[model samples]
Target: MTGSTVGGQLAEELQEIRERSGLSLAALASRTPYSKSSWERYLNGKKPVPRQAVDALCALTGTSAGRLLALWELADAEWSGRARPVSAPKEPQVPDRPAPSPAPPTAAARAGVRWWTVAAAVAGVTAACLAVLAFVGGSPDEQARTATEPPVRNHGCRADTCEGKSAVAMGCGAAGMITTLATHTASDGRRLELRHAKLCHAVWVRATGLMPGDRVELSLPAGRTQSVTAEGSLDAGRYLATPMASGDSRTSTRICLDVPDRHPECFTG
Candidate 1:
């Protein structure tokens, strides 16, 4: 695919994620190291999104980052296409100067002198070229590729490597994290989910509209469980996360949210 097409598609996805996240470019800039103008260019397809920016946006939105990072890989490959050779620069022409006056000489002498002049000119040009090559150290095409090459991506770990960790923080969300497997909405409008981080071989709980004293939990077989409590009221749209636990689709995983004075609500996936 063309770089523009790939970049535009990635940009559209990022813009959608940003809008859903309710974070402004300035917020994104502040949250990450990127500048506001950089985020603007990234969302507008004026440039390819770097791996760091993609991961940062996904973490900010509490969204799975795998799909976006995959899209970014494609865009970067297109943008950093094969480098072309840099053509030699043409030397500027100088007006011919009058030949210096010389005494008349034999025909053989004139030929030898002319041959010597040509040899010296060739040697001078060759030496100058060697000096340039020594200074440059590498081909222009190599330098161009180095300049435009994409940054290395670390997609986080898989399976055991991701067990009991924050998917967003460890970059699992940027790779093999999956969509919500099960969802539950509480009587008070709080929402909970059993999320499958497939690459992580684990599951976790995420809840929104949490109130102070709200407790969220993710449980697996053999009594392994992890939970989190809201210390204070949280924004309705902000998600509260629990530490992950080892589990997969083959096994049932349950997520629950318990509010004070209310019965615990739970769902299994």
Candidate 2:
């Protein structure tokens, strides 16, 4: 099957199973770790569905593993099928034969690692250097660089970024920090809506070029900010400021900030 066809079919089957189980999208999501929007994407084939997700759905709805596994195979085939196709069928059947243990990492994976990993390591080194520079009385140039640099947004705060406090207020905190300040002008000169995130402490937003009626939404986890409402005539050049936090932790303090597009220097700084 084509990618779209298999994806669409899997989505349909998933939806069918959900309905048969009498589970709302949110309720089904609650049963599993996947989010409601993620389930929607799986059902609509907006994104590739993970095998674990399929397994979770089967476990939740008490669906037949054989059938669900078949659907998963179909979806996997759409992306992996070759000119002649391999013996791996559209639906994987657990045969009577026992499975072999998996092999170690391939030479390629070990060779260079991944570009993203390298980039992340580099960013970490850079952040550490900046933190050191910040701790010590750094020069004006160094301070400016640190101030202008974009924040490295880390997804899992559990141990690395968080203190691992089991309490909800301490552990389940979210925050969005500022990494860079940019200058932009609105075409036709209209006020842009300011947005931010609220983790533990309420976010403090200070922005220019924003008039009344502008709306803001705080994105948790990733702490992405988006504008929802707008008012007043937007000006060409304006400055905006927002103070946000997820409450300070022993391991993690500030949330990683996103580097806006067209700000490579900011990221490097």
| lDDT of model number 2 | 0.45
Clash number by candidate, in order: 0, 8
Candidate with maximal lDDT:
1
| CA deviation > 4 Å runs, candidate 1 | 1-153, 234-237
Per residue, candidate 1 scores C-alpha lDDT tens digits across 37-96 of 988998988876777678768766877776787887767666765323433444346488
lDDT of 2 at 42: 81
lDDT of 2 by residue, 1-269 (tens): 22357767887787788888888878855545467897788877787666556766775564545677677766665534322332322232446754375765678865455555666666777797778867887764445434432232322223223322211112121223322222233442432222222232223223344444443332334543322233344421343333233332221222212222422111100
Residue 85 of model 2 has an lDDT of: 38
Name the candidate that leads on TM-score: 1
What are the Cα lDDT values of the candidates?
0.70, 0.45
Q: Which stretches of candidate 2 lie over 4 Å from their true place?
A: 1-4, 80-269
